[model samples]
Target: MMPCYSGYTKSGDKFFICGKLGPHCADARCMDVGTILCDYPVGDGKTCDMPICESHAFEAAPNVHYCPGHALMWRKFVDAGGVERDLKNVVPFAAKERT
Candidate 1:
């Protein structure tokens, strides 16, 4: 599993994404195995945190994340040979693609 998650939200079944300070997701459906994806409506605002929650909310700047501790643990999991089920390299593949 990824140390963190990335996606939007759903109100009826997709409300919105709430970063580390995450919102209530016990209601959303499981879009991904071992993970949850949701969506929500964006509100009108004018501040630094505004873009963080765009109207489209399509900003894929890492939808969600694990706490620092979990992030570290996840790193160890991969380094110690944890299975990577994602198509993209858990370690990143852009480098190889660029070559």
Candidate 2:
């Protein structure tokens, strides 16, 4: 990820879409119509990513518009091996492309 990020750094902070979806992460990077905005990857550990710590999404209107991107920043944070440890290991972030 840092490799892609380094290239981006030279280009300035333009928006670049990144996702761990499909094979490596089996992540569904995009949403479809009728996806129910509040839906947060509901399924088994293989198919879905939501942890048991969360409650089901709301059924009513208004707040249900949030997608997982807008939800908690758990996946990447966890993948980075937790924030405190990441800093202690103390290396610059890497671009996955470079690796």
Candidate 3:
């Protein structure tokens, strides 16, 4: 007996997205379809882009959401009682918010 695949690309390399093949939520325990991306800025005007379901996403600002990992970090910063001006240094693109 042999296994079958529809395409030449390896399964791991395939890019699954929302819809039929549905991208999975990044959370290991969750099986929900990922419909949104984490908005955490990475660099060069790019974002984290981690696929996440709504339930697992943290809304940082209007329509901006972060994955669980970044979200936790954000929460910790807030809980630490950092001043508002310090946010510009903590977040990758927060300096733009000040402009």
Say which candidate scores most in TM-score. 3
What is candidate 2's TM-score against the reference? 0.17
Q: Tell me the lDDT of model 2 at 63.
A: 41
lDDT of 3 by residue, 1-99 (tens): 322212113343433223354577788776666668999989999999999877788999999999999999888888887646586678464445565
lDDT of 2 by residue, 2-98 (tens): 2111112334543343353222211243221122334444556322333211122232235433234534544566566786776788878877876
> How much is the lDDT of residue 56 in candidate 1?
25
Candidates in order: C-alpha RMSD to true structure: 17.0, 18.0, 10.8
> What C-alpha lDDT does candidate 3 achieve relative to the native structure?
0.74
Q: Which stretches of candidate 2 lie over 4 Å from their true place?
A: 1-67, 83-99
User: Residue 72's C-alpha lDDT in candidate 1?
Assistant: 51
Clashes (N, CA, C under 3 Å) per candidate: 14, 8, 0
TM-score of each: 0.23, 0.17, 0.63
Clashing residue pairs in candidate 3, if any?
A: none
Question: Candidate 3: where is the Cα deviation over 4 Å?
Answer: 1-21, 87-99
lDDT of each: 0.36, 0.36, 0.74
- Tens digits of per-residue lDDT, candidate 1, 1-99, equal 223333444443443332444332232332212232322222463222312222223332376433323345556766777645453456654645565
